[model samples]
Target: MTGKSLADYQKEYERIIFFDQPRKDILLEGLQTEMEKQFKLPMRSKEWKKENQKIIAMYRKIVITRTL
Candidate 1:
């Protein structure tokens, strides 16, 4: 029941968006790593376009909010 406050979490998230590199870059890199593990691929290829699109779409849907 004890952890970082909502504001602190939101700040961290925003930092990732603003101070960090482009969101797409981060998302694609992580997605590529995961897809590589799941599919045993050595690297992302043109064939993975659809999977990448789906992952990016889902990533955009995530919402972070603050309540206080």
Candidate 2:
């Protein structure tokens, strides 16, 4: 309502959708549904070693997007 334009709000909307993490509950729900449709991924690999760097990266994106 200040000096902001529609373009400013549009960019903010995109940032919130893309950068901000969703609630954990929503994330879990989406993961469950999407998992069924997903084929084997570089994420859920059978050859994962103890390091698990790839798995951790995927987890960070899904559940650890923001600190609580």
TM-score of each: 0.31, 0.27
Local distance difference test scores for all models: 0.42, 0.42
Report the C-alpha lDDT of model 1 over 1-68, residue by residue, as the tens digit: 44443344334445544433456456445544444454444234656646565543333332222111
Global CA lDDT of candidate 2, please? 0.42
Report lDDT (Cα) of residue 62, candidate 1.
29
| lDDT: worst 10-residue window of model 2 | 32-41
Query: After TM-score superposition, what is the CA distance of residue 35 in candidate 1 from its true location, in Å?
Result: 0.5
TM-score of 2: 0.27
Please provide, for model 2 over 5-68, each residue's C-alpha lDDT reduced to its tens digit, 9 standing for 90 to 100: 3344334334444543445445444553343234223445546523555433444454443344
